[model samples]
Target: MPLTGYTIPRSPTGRSSLVPYPPWHYVGDFLVVEYWADPDKAVTVLPNGLDPHPDAGRCALVFADWQSCSDAGGELLDPSRSQYKECFVVVNALLDGEEVTTCPFIWVDRDFALTRGWLQGFPKKLGSIWVTRTFGLDSPADPGVRAGARFGATCAAYERRVAEATVTLERISETGPTHNDPPIVNVRHFARLEAGRHDEPAVHELARSRSRDRIVSPVWEGVATLSLYGAEHEEHDLLAPVRVGKGFRFTFGYTVDDQEIVKDIRS
Candidate 1:
């Protein structure tokens, strides 16, 4: 068989011709809150070849309002073109004796974001995400500079609710790191068919750099309350928060540039 040479447009006209590119840029406000869970429960959800760090009972919940674009300049032209929201849950774990984080569940509101995330190996599902901020009014004598923020997210699969949570914060202050945690690691799973003959599923353990190509303009910490709901999907039970930890909010932007795949999971 002979092949024809043709130019593939950067912005393909059809869905079937879409190509995934790197340096994906996103500008967003996010809330990152950690919670304490049963240590035994945390270990159970991890995929094969990953283990929870001994004494690793921490779960982090993130709510993000994203204005994402394929390139840096596209964001300023029309920020609303690819605006979306996402919420995800990750737990501290160990991979090959190194501390890492594992995301067992996540939800996003946009289809393009969902598809892009899946290509990156995130366990992302479609759902609704809402975040709100309220400022407190101060009297003339006293200058009040505090505000409250609320985050809510719900995920459904096959017409059933899989997981949902509400997090509220009354006060936030710009502060330093309250705790030192390891970089995030994800179980990336995708399938590839080569030459329409060879089919194989890839499951890799990927780690993201903690400080590269990421901008945290201002990081704020606050006290928060978390309320988790029951789930129709049993896998989500691993995320049920038993105790609350520190709450944080930040304005962040990042370019997806450096990621190391530690190992591949074959089983």
Candidate 2:
């Protein structure tokens, strides 16, 4: 889907966000994510590793999104489900109006018919995931060539050749022959993430209730409103209300009006 809206990252300095975003591409047929950082912000990836991505330094917020690299890439999303929209919404929430470049992405099933399967990763790679941006290929080849690399005895050399080659792919259309060329999907990175507290706990009451099964409950003191999180759920149509009536009053369960006491726990 085309990105229709743009929101400025809510940075006090009006610069970047509290966090930095990193580079990640999907690998399922067309679910691959291939992206780069701004020239100044990006770090060149060495060829020693099979996977390549930029390093997000110390920052509070991180950017994230999924992309479709092939024609079938769009099928994995059930936008009708809450999770899909929530995924983007969550990424946005974490960013808090920070600029995050999420390339439009896609996903396809394991065997969507193409005359070629990426051969370098085949048999073992087939039915698995393959990124459109070849790790070493000068350009991504057709399914035939990618799948053809499977028959060589010097498999390691074949892999290194494929990895070093510049990436290529067909157009990410729903139904079109694999194009001879593919675009370098560029997702913008803004911040680096240092894992820390998203939320914290304030202990209100850590009371012990003695029962055969050991039912221990704690009261949590939250901001402004004291909210409770852990409580037993009753299954049989649990709809009950606080009952009040004449000659009755609401107070602590065991109490005489206007008197409060803190009993010794030793009892």
Candidate 3:
């Protein structure tokens, strides 16, 4: 029989054991906090050949509840494979004279999400994420979408709390959130497995996410607070916010099938 597979642990079936082939569709509700971090510290996390945004060192900490499905849409029926949560930090930077955003750190709760993120150049790891959920009940226990409503979220890994954020909805935004509006840039890096080829990576390049059918819901912006805690193995604290800005809550959807390689380091 001819071998067939798109990813690891291949079987006679071409389907990947982890995640199916794209175009993967996603719908997510997010709580985002925008802030400025130490410019010097922020620059340290950017991949080589990129520079910090000339205006300021801006970063957005995002907590998301996501539902994803492949083109076949079978995963939607199998909820286990389609639902997950994530937390990530995106920093604004300059790539080849153009403004771009890069994800320096990210954590997801599902193995499939983690593997999928790796393929897209996001360095995703396992973490527990919790976000305040809203309900439709007309009672105090259920928070409604309106002024004075507060939302909170937290992310932790290896039993260590990494970050926390709180946002109090003050008003609806007409222009939407600005923190993550730029094109996303990421570095795809995979080291060679052979001991002798340790210095050379199998893949090392700058990539931009190419997502279609993007949609954004009405955004809610308000006062916000964020705190970052340093863990023994995590360096995210280095990007701790120097000045916290507006907080936003929004829902968005998009489809991803491919990426654009901006530069190949090894070429």
Candidate whose TM-score is highest: 3
Q: If ranked by lDDT, best first, what sequence of candidates would result?
A: 3, 1, 2
Return the top candidate by lDDT: 3
Tens digit of lDDT per residue, candidate 1, span 49-166?
7787876788877778888766545545764556888877788877788777777788888776777676566788887776643234554443232444444545555556655555
Runs with alpha carbons beyond 4 Å of true place in candidate 1? 1-20, 75-80, 133-181, 191-211
How well is each residue in 1-267 modelled by candidate 2, as lDDT tens digits?
332211234354532321112111121111111222232222221111111222221011111121222223333363221011000000100112222221111111232111111111111121111222223445435222231221110001122211111112222223221110111112221222445622321211111111122121121111110101111321101111112111100011111111111122221
Summarize candidate 3's per-residue lDDT along 70-132 as a digit string, tens digits.
Answer: 888999998999999999999999998888899999999999999889889999999999998
Ranking by TM-score: 3, 1, 2
Task: Check candidate 1 and list the clashing pairs.
Answer: none
- lDDT of model 3 at residue 232? 95
Error of 2 at 94 (Å): 8.0
TM-score of 1: 0.75
- Residue 212 local lDDT, model 1: 45
Candidate 2 vs 3: which has more TM-score: 3
Model 2: lDDT to the true structure: 0.18
lDDT of 3 at 252: 92
**Clash count list over all predictions:** 0, 36, 0
